[model samples]
Target: MVDVATLEKRPPSTIALLEEMERAYKDLPMEAIVKQDILRQGIHFLPEAFQVIGEYKSKDYFIFSFDHIPLADLKDGADTKAPEEIKIQGGYFDLLKTVISTRNNPHSPYKMKSVEGIPTLFLGDISIGQAEYPPIPSWYKHKTKNGKFPGEIAPVIEWGYLLYLTVFRNCQYFGKDEECAYCDINHNYRQQKGAGRPYTGVKDVEDILEVLSWVDQEDQVAKVYTITGGSVLTSLKKKNEVDFYLQYPEAIEKAFPKRWMGKLVAQAFEKEDCRKFKDAGIEIYHPNYEVWDKQLFEKICPGKASWIGWDTWIRRVVDSAEVFGPDKVIPNFVGGVELSEPWGFKTVKEAIDSTKQGLDFFMNKGIVPRFTAWCPEPYTTLGQQAGPPLVYFCELLRAWKETFEKYNLPTPPGYGEPGPGKAVFSVSAFMDVIGYSGRN
Candidate 1:
């Protein structure tokens, strides 16, 4: 019999795994299947492929490191050379344009190579698709009056459909006891500083406004702006979490006045507190509940459990629906985290069942839940571990799609178009699987 370590070291063939999952989940688009695999495992860039760095929007360390390996471990300056995201199309799969966020994992079977002088994505020796990097926004050329790069202050993600502003780089939730087990916000900040990147700890409102002024004047592709960062537990700059976070949208809407779809990702708040964001012109709210399992919530999110308690968190999420309206009050869970090691469910069935329950609870009330495919980045409390199988993500996507349609819900605002190929929401296939009518 093969030893567990040997079995763990050798995964089933990549193409074979895709084929098996395709047959098992035929309703899910092939585009989404491939996207989820890349998101979970990350991609390694060849030296030749790294040549495209300056020509495109490179990874900005926008929030978390979002890499399988830390910056210290990545060779050949991949930390700075990797593209913010890649769009895959035309290969063995004849895939449509699918945008996927970049996560560097040198060991991932998927590799970015310059195949015959063309940028390409490969699984083992098989070419998956022609890879296209996002173009640099013209405004990225300009610096804030204080000498800040636009990408550092305000970066565009989702193929330039969303402006990602991480105002507070460091979370007040310090140490393993307080940080989310799978998160690396605090660690990513340290690695960035260690690497001598000019990452800001806390961005001033004026600096953010200055960046947006350039964005507003020069860009038209950005349809939404998401004001988000690490959770503010006690206080940031002497302001409470609400006051600290609320200031961004409040200032943006005050300055721009509904120029872009305004969104916020923060802790779940009471009905009245939720109104503060709504009143400030935030059209969409994302109170990300990282996982659905109750026990996992206690173990994985001890800080939140200790500070707010899961019961209160859930209640706050539900109550916020009144303020933002059910459809606009979207919540995000970290996909595949329900199956994380040591504390997670023993089987996918248990994980799916638990997550599906949460979906039903929310979707039944017109609140559509969303998720980002979990990347097990290093140095977090969970450390580096094998993420859930591709099948788990496929199942989660299906559950999300079916529940979404069951309610005949509108596409959650802020995220660009839903459905395979057209989806720019690179983090998870939840958006890609939307409106899919089974594979041909």
Candidate 2:
């Protein structure tokens, strides 16, 4: 949150940009357009507004920093003070209850400030909505025998609707030549350590079980738990990539079968490797095809391109659908990565057309893809520059929604409910744009 006394004035053109985008993209919800802009640009929270989230759940740095600026650049003590996500309800544009992932940017024109101790979201001077912070879950009070709180071991996102367990904090993709250009996993892990926070690089298996035990007993809102982390290229405690991540689900399912829907977000493994996860009782598989464009995929994700090669990686994605079932094999693609510079499509139409070809290829076979709106976190390589325009995201959503309907696909499972207000997967408005009513 910012120190209001030292807040600097920013250009008012951003508000005008938002209005222009809204007017142009009338088919898409105003909520979707505004949320995309806020995510792309990031937000600066005034101290007065930060006070409104008293004792609420703060960010756990799940995998990436997801901030516009690096942790060192944040002057406002927003590193640990800002709420995990903000839910804003009807105000300036009569916006529905939209849940947005918090990304701190001190210079953003969109600021969160308090008006009479009630959290109010603003675009310049205009009110957008009243912001609501997510309350701390009941399980947060309990601790494991090793003296670790459940919140650190397994943090929940989407307003406490899903449990996120990033078991391997750091990726084996070590440097600029290896790691994905847009990813900040290694850097964020180092920064968290520098900050003196209790960020574990490799969480213990028993610790995960102990924490989830509390979640099992105390939590009811959590319907899904995702077991994920940075890729394991070499070894994690003498276990290969598949063996290392397998322990969590194998143990969880053994203890409580079908307790909560289990999802795995990992590297694109071959059919045989993927079946081990399915056999271990994992319900959904997300082998995220980071981007659809082949040439950009090579330049941006060097390690993945080198190790598996783009063709092999895509085949594995389709092969995984056979083992996990097409509907359950949900491969994720970074929505805006294809539009990144130095090695991306120059036009929005070109970007959409290239991505849609991939989408259609998957959807035709029944494998569905979902995306998280890209955050131009200034720390990462591609993120050093700005992301795609608001128009790109708007059209992306429209294409995604229309294609989903065209294929007559079922809603992707695990993320709570579809449509705005009801949807809790806040990282992107993919869920928000789907089945949106005027209310949400």
Candidate 3:
């Protein structure tokens, strides 16, 4: 077991730790290392920081809260003021441009401040880089005929490279026993609703279509649209999980006829169900296996374990590759959850080895597994404790890159280009580290 006291405490300095990591993981880009550290620890925006953020794309509460603290705890209007993602470049590391998603954590060593006139990311006294906020999509300025803003209906993320549509916001996983311990989906819904945000529970096809019309006509940046939401365990809108999610893609493909690459993030399903999505024009399928270890999956994601069973879920993920094409069938694991508090591995080496097993299992078959650096949101079962250390993420980036290159796989479709300064998949450094040729 990890020593809680020892694990929770930071080293003498954040910069020193980062520099040390840079030296150790020579193959990984400095941009990726810094991006992962900011993502793993989350970011704190000083009150003055928002002054520089003039009309940027704000966080849409996309899918999960993805914050270290609750919305109620936000004191500086960060809930509304914070940008959806920040692109950092040129600091102590002389980093290339790297995009990172926003996750609010007031206590994190990384802080966002407006230095002179530019939004800059600072770790201790060191200026990590100049931070650039995502631009407001033109469609964001217009509302649907029914008065819903396009952002609420279909927000663009990954620096506006993809449109995110969470059709069923609440998961059927219900409570502590069922909900993934690291996920804040259900809780985020409640908080978003409680805060009086126009957060939709079950989005209407008409509403989504209207927003897509705006995006199709007004926006040029988005190349992909993802139809995802919480798992429909019993039934949502009186339809089973696969049937419930299938409608959106069907409507999108029919209406736009493949205007943008379509991707679906939903629970694993049989080959028959996977074919329906492939028939509907979805280019990619993400049956998110939240964790790799059987025991960890059961402990961290009890609902998925109980309903689908690990063995069956694994089989479905492999089987669906035939329908979507193995390269297109991408499974996502929550990156650091293998080291999550009580149930996680005792050491980073054990955690890396366990996750790499999952990576190799799929990648060897041409199904690439990607990860979002786990954010320990306050509402989830495992949120109270600290997340995995920064070293864990650095190791994960290296492992992911090594496995990806071993198979000589193509860059996963829909997630823009890869490599430092070019990648737009901002949630983690998996994309950022690709094709990196920095110091060894």
Candidate 4:
């Protein structure tokens, strides 16, 4: 419970801005607007807030350290105390059940505290909603023979709706030369190791199978499992990227064929190479194109642009559709990277317009792209700067929705559900904006 005096209510201007956006984008749900802003700006928890979080699942650092500040910067020891995701409902705006990923920023206006002994989220002083954390899965208590916890082996995210298996923790594209500018994968691995957490660089296939045995036996909610890791530009364990990544799904499907939907998040390989994953029972492929604008893509993802080249990367994304079907070939773009400072577009309109073109291109081809809200993590090259404005995200959501509806694409397979009250894809509001018949 944050001390009442220690928690400052949001300044008047902040609430006004949110209210104004809500009114302006009447067709878009107020919940989506708030969710996007919460993600963009990040959240803070008062020391007392941990009392409520202790019983729920804590942040797993599943992939990237999606925090605005590094673990060393947290004042109230929030790094280890924060929940994986928080669900908000019945706040000042009477928000529906909206799930937002936990991105620790001790200075954020959005604060979580136990107000009057009840867990609540406060947007500057106004109580927005009662807060609830995802339950720690029963399988979480189990560990592998190598003394690795299931969380470090294979963590479940999206509020326990999906299994996240990060087989290779470190990306080969290290430093400014190759690593994506907005990414902190390499830095996060170091921080976790420094924190003395069991951060494995390369998890063994046997460990993964051991974890899944618990998932298969005790878990009932996880329907999809994604096997992803940092890009293996050269070779990992004497295997090429495709061959290395293929082992997990290959093994999983071999052991429990079709027990759960298998998805792969890896580099966009040649069409023929992707067929190997499909044949191994992987149903979805996400060759993430970090950003859309050609200039920005090269600038933000130098290694990817240098190695795959933007044209071939896009081409392979399209090419993979033939192997996985158009609907299954879903590439992800960091939603607000086009609005990043320095090399990015100068204004929200320019950014959205540029991104819209990319969305239109892929949507026209029957391949849909999804995005996670960018957190300006301090360790990355583009670190600690204020991220894109909330307005940019709202406009981006609108553009994404209009373009998606224009194509009449089916609901993306692995993301749990769609629509405002029902959406569980916490990173972005793409899921929330769907079925919004009110789109103007």
Error of 1 at 124 (Å): 1.5
Collision count of model 3: 0
Question: Local distance difference test, per candidate?
Answer: 0.88, 0.84, 0.89, 0.88
Residue 220 of model 3: what lDDT?
Answer: 87
**Residue range 118-188, candidate 4, lDDT tens digits:** 67999878988998889999999987889999888999888999999999999999999999999999999
> How high is each candidate's TM-score?
0.96, 0.95, 0.97, 0.96
Clashing pairs in 1: none
Q: Which candidate number has the best lDDT?
A: 3
Which portions of model 2 miss their true places by more than 4 Å?
1-13, 437-440
Off by over 4 Å in 3: 1-13
Instruction: Give the number of colliding residue pairs in candidate 2.
Output: 0
lDDT, candidate 2, at 46: 83
RMSD of each: 2.8, 5.1, 2.3, 4.8
Name model 4 segments beyond 4 Å from true.
Answer: 1-13
Give the clashing pairs for model 3.
none
Clashes of 4: 7
lDDT of 3 by residue, 32-127 (tens): 888888888888999888887368888998899989999989869798888999999998999889999999989888999988989999999899
Worst 10 residues of 2 by lDDT: 2-11
| Model 1 lDDT tens row, 203-268 | 989999999999999999999999898888777899999999999999999999989999999888
